[model samples]
Target: MLTLKGKSVFAGITIGPLALFHRNTISTASHTVENPEVEVIRFQKARDESIEQLKGLYDKAVQKVGEEQAAVFEVHQMMLEDDDYVDSVEEKIRNGKINAEAAVDQTAQELADMFRHMEDAYMQARAADVLDISRRVEQQLCGGAGIDFSKYDHVIIAADDLAPSETLQLDTDRILGFVTSSGSTNSHTAILARTLGIAAVVNTGNQLHNDVDGLMAIIDGLTGMVYIDPDEDTLSQMRIKQQEEKACKARLEQVRHVPTVTRDGRVIKLFANIGNPGNLPQVLANDAEGIGLFRSEFLYLENSDYPTEEQQFEAYKKTLEVLEGKTAVIRTLDIGADKQVDYFDLAPEVNPAMGMRAIRICLTRPDLFKTQLRALCRASAFGKLAIMFPMIISVAEVRKAKKILEEVQIELDEKAIAYDKDMEVGIMVETPASAVMSDELAKEVDFFSIGSNDLTQYTLAIDRQQTALDAFFDSHHPAVLRLIQQTIENGHKAGIWVGICGELGADLTLTETFLRMGVDELSVSPPAVLPLREKIRSLDLNKA
Candidate 1:
């Protein structure tokens, strides 16, 4: 028996035969071409074919996983069409007089390497996207070879790594789970795995091998452990664990309609955080009380260009309408930092986390900010909608954003556009400065949603994206908890409700702590809603 440990991207238990996933490697050998123009045409043809393939994948992904997860393929399509990327490939082909395959291979390497060497971990993950798209184009150039998985059944896939597209393309019914040698929790593959509710363990290094293929294996996603050719005792234990987990899930269904109230009569709102309107089905299925953090940036990130106000309005309207009177707190354009869009034209920054991002960008470019505000305000009439500004550190920034919002409202009023005149406005208490100034900032906004992810990152002066600092990137540090506690206290004192809209909100270990701190609400991923509610119902703040 061989035991390997990895990071859990999802919590589950799966027992199956191991199946090694082998991705075809593109040959990088350079060859002289008689005509550079002909090679350029060949490259363009392959690129176009790759884009078409991505479109098909995007559609497949939308049906399997919601549009929120499917949006990665849309981004991939945009990346393929990026002027710099296309230009680089053409320049290599025309100037170097190399075959289209060699030119493309060389360009992909250079671009992927650039992204890999970037300081930001999110950008570094994007290196995988570059390679994924390049591989698709190269496959098309090489006359395309497809992996036939007809021989595999109920198998746990082992791979060096999986791209978002690759993860989605695999037959989920046949794939009992996946164990990857390399991947971060932030990688798109990990995100897709979580969305699909598949058991997955990543970053196990090179422990997985072809020799293990067809061996009976157990993947304990809850513990991020994989055992290949497990002994009888280990197999028995894993079977029991799987049964227990399945029973726990069945128990969670009982809490679907139950209110997220703690013992001793403390009521809390359990909402779901969503990126796209298409995720509404999961939110409803999971019985989320409301939409806590409707990340409005999806409209920008998934598109090739800036979304029109009407486009934004339609998306907001659909989400709000589907909530059916449940409060949908939509954060305004939190773009920048790890989530960058090429059309934003943001200049390169040494440290983008602290650079012009989120509210700063909205405040600096009111034109862009107003467009989104107009959409939000126009959609307010569809259902309950609350606008939240992200990355606010000072009273001045909040006021500036509100001022722009006011301008948008006035413009809508002059056009006789209908909207919720009393739409609530809030700011994300992400930075320590915002947390410290929560009392005053809370007065300016109608509510406060503590963005614990950034709050902890900024408070500890640790880059959460830096995997090397994972040990030191303490999300549970006393300072971060104190900041959250302080923010909650200050918001309550100012007569404004406070909630947490970060990954920490989903952590069951802290549910009781948050309840004791008088947190009014928590917004987590849709899959976490029922489990969070169960945790809340099991906690008694009085005992704490």
Candidate 2:
């Protein structure tokens, strides 16, 4: 029997039949064809059939899950309708003069190659989606049906990777867990698994499939561990532990509506981090105090150019209307080397993370910065709106950004546009330099929100994106803890509130540590708010 172990982020254990996802190998023709028009036609027909199948899948998802939960598929639907993507395929078919199937295959390969060349990991991941859709099309053209796993009683899905659509087809009653060769905790597969309450492990290495089929194996999702041919004693213990864990989670939900105050009567505000305006419903459902981070980069990415003031106003207003009376801390555009905007005409830098990004970008492009400020200020008149800047390294940049904001406010006044002049402004302390200079920056900004994810990466000089160095990027390192403590102290000394808007704030294990460090607010994923509130309510602040 073989054993594999990794850090456990979520907890659960299950034993089931293994269903592995192996990569499909494409066999291309050896001879080069002069005219491939016939292949292109065939490819187009296949692509159309795949689109229809995807539509059917969408309908099934809506029927199984509520429309709101299934709304994630809308982007996939749009991809099919995208003019540029369709044109690219047509151009290849006409120019290359290849067979329809060959043309489709070649075009798909080109699209994937283009995305892979981009610097952003998020964009690079999109290549997988493109390849997945093309493969589905190819299968349909060849009259190939997906593998049937309906007979399995309890099964575990093992795959090179699972796309959102592929995951939705899972037989929940029979599928108990998932193991993938490549994926991340933040990927769509992981998100779907969490929502479905299924156990999953990614990046398990290639050797796992040696004896996977028909093997009686046990998997612990929380720890990302797999045990082959577990002894009866181990299985029995796992079952008992699983039941106890479920009971604990159920108990945690009982305090969903409770206040987050320590045993000694210290209040700690908890909010939710939102990626887009569409997520407002979930945030409201969790009874979040307000939004901690409203990432505005999505608007920039969806469009070819910068979003107009009216468009920005509409998005901001919708969030404020939904959260009415509560605070909504809206973060400005954070595009940089990692996130590219085609309209921005940005030059590629060797070290994007260290290059011009966040507040730095805004400083360089004040006109774009002013437009966002105007929209935000106008939206603030309707509700509590707080402006938060990202990737701030020094006080000088904060002061300069504030000057532009003031100029925007003056322009609004000249135009007789009503706005809130008293709206508070804050900075994201994600860099070691910012953390060390918190005492200076605290005096300039109204508040501070520690971005522990980036802060830890910078402090330890480790690239979190590089899997080989993930071990050294520990958030609990003494250096990270000290920085958090000092930042909180500096903010309090300057008579301003300090909060955390990073992944660490939502972590169950570090809840006590943050409370002890005197963090005033904790912003996390919406699903975690209630549990965190309950933890805060149970804590004895004075004891800490």
Q: In model 1, what is the error at residue 188, expressed in angstroms?
A: 4.4
Model 1, 369-445: lDDT tens digits are 99999999999999999999999989998888888999998999999999999999998999999999998998899
Write the residue-wise lDDT of candidate 2 on 1-544 in tens digits: 6676643323577877675655445544323456666555666677677777777877887786545446556666667567876677667667765444555567678888887777665666667667667677667656657745564457776677777777777777778877776655644455556656677776677546656676776778766887767778877877787788788778877877777788889988889998777667668777799998898887786566789988999889888988978899999999985788778888777777888888888999988998888889999988999999999889899999989999998888999988877899999999999999999999999999999889988999887777898766787889998999999999999999999999999888999888888899999988788878888888886772
Specify the poorest-scoring 10-residue window by lDDT in model 1.
Answer: 115-124
Candidate 2 yields a Cα-based lDDT of: 0.78
Segments in model 2 whose C-alpha atoms lie over 4 Å from true places: 4-11, 21-35, 62-72, 91-97, 113-118, 144-153, 207-211, 278-287, 302-305, 322-325, 341-343, 413-421, 466-474, 477-479, 507-510
Candidate 2 backbone overlaps, count:
14
lDDT of 1: 0.88
